[model samples]
Structure formats: structure tokens, C-alpha cells
Target chain A: MSERSPKKTDTMTEAERDAYHAEKMKKKKAARDKILATKTEERGLVIVHTGRGKGKSTAAFGMVFRAIGHGFNVGIVQFVKGKWGTGERDVLEKFPEQVTIRAMGEGFTWDTQDRQRDLAAARSAWDAAKAMIADETYKLVLLDELNICLRYDYLPLDEVVETLRNKPRDTHVIVTGRNAKDELIEIADLVTEMTEIKHPFRAGVKAQAGIEF
Target chain B: MSERSPKKTDTMTEAERDAYHAEKMKKKKAARDKILATKTEERGLVIVHTGRGKGKSTAAFGMVFRAIGHGFNVGIVQFVKGKWGTGERDVLEKFPEQVTIRAMGEGFTWDTQDRQRDLAAARSAWDAAKAMIADETYKLVLLDELNICLRYDYLPLDEVVETLRNKPRDTHVIVTGRNAKDELIEIADLVTEMTEIKHPFRAGVKAQAGIEF
Candidate 1:
């Protein structure tokens, strides 16, 4: 798609280039305008970010920043991250008026090695998640590491899908983690897989404070 | 990997669950600490976000938010997304002391249709990017949509890679866009390709505020 554009030329003067460029852009704009006219629907999305690479949660946090920028109320439920004192959490805590965060996790399953406790934690987080999604006051809800819970059947996948299917019309729900289930994917409006191209951890580089947390 | 963990069961009492969880967590912590002991290197990273999916810029902005929370000075240079008054821009502008945003794009290449203008804009943005990377005061520098410029040959790939390769040791450099150059990837400590599994645009859903902006 990028290669379709004409390459730079040294022979043309600045003024000449400007006129030619303007003409081409005009035609492109007309085509773009036609496409814009066809897009009339505006509804909240069921967004899923998954795969082996990073940024699944990071991107959702980015959406949180944008939502905060727009003065929209946001709710965050870290399903398994717990209270690691993440930088994002610290920053989010500063915006109490616009944000409501519930770090309702008791570490990973392997870390806890207790079934009832894991189920209790997942149920607690899911309850919080359902409340936030059902709440009309919030515009965005982020469920971090929800996929892992579903993958382990900590929470019923059908219940999660049903809740998302019947969410408030204008409330966006973002779920992030690796190995997202297929049923969730089928029901999602947007799904992105963050494929790992290169990773610093394999090179023995430790995670930094601001970047990783 | 999440599947390897044991599932929830109803038989265990709360006290038993706690004891088991504590014992397992202790062993897991010991193993984690041993691995962590080997990771001694700490320095700035050359991070690249590229692919055909959403959140390349969004995730970088998430990092920007985290950096800001940590009170790290940040610099942002938009190579192609000129000011249409993005939500993130509005938020970043509020923190004047910590962020320096330079929006030098002249719209999309098709919109401008001018090679010289594109080249000039790229040069200006690259100048700002290099300065931010070289400056010790800034801890993180985000070059948004820089991959598009490099893919189009608007900026010199070798020069950009060279600049990043020789950047200050403590300043993190994040370049985001689709189709990143191989040279940049070759030197980058982290690379993520955001693969598109499903997109709302395909369903004729227009971009909404606080989500797509």
C-alpha cells in the first residue's frame, strides 16, 4: 500500500511538487470521503488483546489514558496482577475522580496452588468486572489477564460471553492476556494478537520499573 | 501454560486452601528469585511496535503514561499523524513540564501529495527525535508512526538506526508504526507485531471517541 505512492524526485521544484501533491491528495480525499459516508454505526466494542507478545495490557492502559483524557469514567479490574504497585496503578490512583480500580487477585495459580482460593479470587474479580460493565456511569472497563482465568476455566466462558453480549450500549470492555479462548474470540468485535518478534527477557535483560510494571 | 496449573475444586476448606497456597507460593518464589538473580543487566531499550493490527501507537502511549507517573521527562514526535486534535495529544499537553510533543506531519502522504513537504517534515521530526534521544533530561522518547516514514524512504533508514544504536544509555526509545525496517528490528531489544484478528472497521463501524482516537 505504501509503495503505491510515487517516490521522491530531485528534479521537481518545491512549488511544482506542492501543486502535484495537492492534486493527488484531492482525488484521494474524495474517495476517502465516500467511504466515510458509509460508516454510520457507533457502538461500544468488545475488544480482546491476546497472544504471546507484550502490550496486550499496555494498549488497554493506553485506551485508559485516552479515556481519562476525554474525561470519561473508567473501571479497571486486574484479574491476576494483584497489588504489585504498578506504575499505571500509581498514576491511575491519582485520578480517583475518574477511575475506580480493584486489584482483586491473589497472585497466579501456580503461585497460590489452591483451588478454592483461586476460584474465590476469580469470582471476586468477575463480580467486580460484571458490575463495572453493567454500570452506566463508566465509559470504559479494562479486565487485565482475564484470558488466563478463562483458559483455566476459573470462570465459565459462557457467562463471560453472555455478559459482554448484553453490556450497556455505550460502555467499552477490553480484555487482555495471552491464549484467549476461541468462544470469546468469536464473540469479540475486535481481536488483536501481539506476536513476539523479539524479546529482551531472552537476552538476560531484566524488566525496568517504568517499562515493565 | 495456564492449563498446566491445577483446576478449582470444592472439597478444600479455607484454612486448607491457605496452607497449600502458602506452601506452593514459597517454592515458586524461590525458583523465581533464583532466575531473577541471573538478570543483572539494566539499561535503556530500543523498543519497536509494528504490524497490521491496532495499538502500536496506543501501547507506546501507555508506556508514556507509565513514564509520566514515574516523573520521567518524555518527548513525542509524530511523523505522520498531524494534529487533528487527538485525545492523547490533549492529555499530554496538560503535562507541559514532563512532555515535549512535536507534531510535524503534513497529513498522510496521499493527503499532502508532496514529496518535498513529506521529506522536510520527516527531517524536522527526526531532528527532534534525535535531540530527545541524545538529551539526558528526557527518559523516554516516542517516535509515533516513524515506521511508515522509514518504509516510504522519507527518512534515511541507516541514519535512523545509527542514531538509535548510539543513543544515550538511560533514555528509552520507542518507535511505532506498521512495517518497521529490518535494520531497526535487528538492533531493537524488543519487537512486537500487532496482528489483526478482527477489526470493527471491516463491519462498517466508525471510529468512536475515547476508543479509536
Candidate 2:
């Protein structure tokens, strides 16, 4: 897989390649136009990012960055990663007015052994999330690691699903964590399960500061 | 779910909550420290992003952005998407010293009808990718939509796999596209299949400029 083959351009004339590429692009444009014409609606979305892979929260943060790039205000509530100082948090916090980030969790459930305490934190975080959902000012609300909290039974699943269901029609909401509940998945407008095929952790690679965070 | 439940905090004194939280965090820190102690290796990764849903390329770009935040040089070779002007490309291009981007393909197979031309483009893109991989200056190399090119038989699967196998040890490479070849997946260090449960396209929402591009 490591060796490079010779360039194929030597065999084809410039004019021949140009003519072929043009004709090809023409057909593609027509097919694309037909598909684009059929798509016409726009609204808020209930997007759930869950899986055993590494990019669930990373992807959610990417969306937050993307939304901010579009000059949209975003609210981020961390459900299980409050203790770690992440690179994304540092970058996002630079935009004070456009981004509001509240690190609510003490840590993961296994780390915080007290069920009662975990439950309290989850409740408080969910309350904050609901407030953001109701606030029309926020274009996107990210519930970071909410799925893990739900999986641990720290928060009631039914209530969480219902609140997501009733969020403002124009405010996109993103929930990210592993082991997303079936109930939440059912109500989500877009659900992505990031299946992990390989992990560096198993190969003895410790989590890096910027990459893992 | 829309209604707020009574705060459980009402039953516990502030002092009690603080003590409980402090105790729980202490235990968590110990567990986390234990896990962190055993993880010690650091090496580059062969990452693959594929599936039916969106975010394959978005996630790859997110990593590139994250890497750049850490002052790492990155090379991006787009194998299938060159016609559209993307927001990520615009943003990444601002950092000329840290990032090198090559948009090689005219479009996808549907857009470019010439199989021979597509093959030539894929080969050219692969050559660019090999150059980046061999150059130790690049910390990460992203082959955007290379999987699609391989899937469509525009590039040889074995050759691509062999090339990836021989890349620099500390240089990470990410390949993004749906329907990745099994051979690539077999040798990848990490693979994520972004399963799509729901999409706005199905609801008649057209791909918006900043959001989609």
C-alpha cells in the first residue's frame, strides 16, 4: 500500500481530458439539480450523536463551531466531562457572546460513586438544558455526554425524550454520548451511532490533551 | 417532559451536598488515575470514516481543525469533491503555513462520467497523498472521499492498502467516504461507521450553504 504508481496523465492529451471531464460534469449537474429541486423545507433538528467511537462529542463541538461560523449563538451543557479542561472549551469560550458553555458534571458515573449525587448533578444539568431549549436566542443547544447520564439512569429517560420533543421548532438540539436510549433515538430527527472499529487505548496509547479532550 | 420536576436538592442541605460531591469526586479521581497509569504508548493512526449518513467529511475536517489548534501541520487531498466551494476549505486556506489542501477530483462518479478520467484523477490524488505521507513534515493527512474512488474501481484497492501500510509511523491519515473497501477497513487502526437514523434531506430540507458545504 505504500508505493506510488506512475502518473497516468502522460498517456492522455490535455484536450481529451478536458472534453471528457466537461461532458461528465454536465450529467452530474443535471442529476444533482433534480435532487436539489425536490428538497425545499427547512426547520430545526433533533440530532443525536451516539456510539462507542471517539467522535460523538467531537462531532457535536464541530457543529457548534460550524454554527458559530454562521454567526449563530450556541449553548453547550456538559453532562459528564466537567473535570477535564478540553481544547474545544478553551476555543469556544473565546466567543463569549456567541457561545455559552456550562460544565455541570463532576465526572463520569464510575468516577463519582454516589448515585444520589450523580442524580442531583444530572437533574441540574437537564434543567439548564431545558432553559436553553426554551430560549429562542440559542440557535443550537448541545447536551454533551447526556446519553451517558441517561444510560447510567442518573436522569429519567422519558422526561429527557419529552423535553427534546417539545423544543422550539427553529432551535437545533444535539445530544451526544454513548449508549443512547431507544426512546431518545426514536424521537431524534437525526441519529448517528459512531461504531468503534479500533481504539488506541486498547493498544496502550494514552489519551492526548488536545486530541482526546 | 416539558414540565420541571421539583429539585431533589431541596431535601439535602447545602453542606451535605457539598460533602457528598467532594467525596464522590475523590473516588473518581483515584479510578481515573489508575486507568491513566496503564496507558503509555503514542503512535500515528490510520482512521477511516464511512457510512450512509453525513458527517464523514465533517468529522475529518474537525480533526484537522483540532490538529491545527495544536500547531500541527496537516495535508488534505480531496479525492471526490472539488467543484463546490466549502466553508471548511475557505477557513483552512487561511493558514497557509500549517495546512496544505489539494482538491483533485472534478466531482463524484455521478458527476464525472469518464471512467478513465476519474481513474486518472484518483491516481493523481493518490500520488499527492503518497507525497504527503512520505513527507515527515505533515502530522496528519486527510484523503477525503478516497473510499468512493476505490469503491467505484477508479483506484486499485490493493495498491491503496499497500501505500497506507507503508506510511510514516507518527503521521496519522484519515480516509472519509461511504462504502469503504473491506481491505482498507481490515488494516485501519480505527474505523467509524456513521449510521444514519434520520436525515433532513428525507424531510425535503435542501443542503444549506454553510451547513452542508
For model 1 the local lDDT of residue A188 reads 91
Expressed as tens digits, the lDDT of each residue in A108-163 for candidate 2 is: 55555666666788888889999999999998999988888886667888889889
Give the alpha carbon lDDT tens digit for every residue of B13-107 in model 2: 85786576667668877878888899897778888989887678777777776776677899989987653244565556556898998878564
True A-B contacts kept by model 1? 0.75
Structural similarity to truth (TM-score) of each candidate: 0.88, 0.80
In candidate 2, how many Å is residue B58 off? 2.0
Per-residue lDDT tens digits for candidate 1, residues B1-213, read 123345453467767766765786689878888888888788999999999999899999999988988888998888875532467877787789999988875734556677677788888889988888889899899999899888766788879989999999988999999989888899999999999999988799998989888
TM-scores, chain A, per candidate: 0.87, 0.86
Per-residue lDDT of A117-197 in model 1, one digit per residue for the tens? 777888999999999999999999999899988876679988998999999999999999999988788889999999999
What's candidate 2's i-RMS value? Answer: 4.6
Best by lDDT: 1
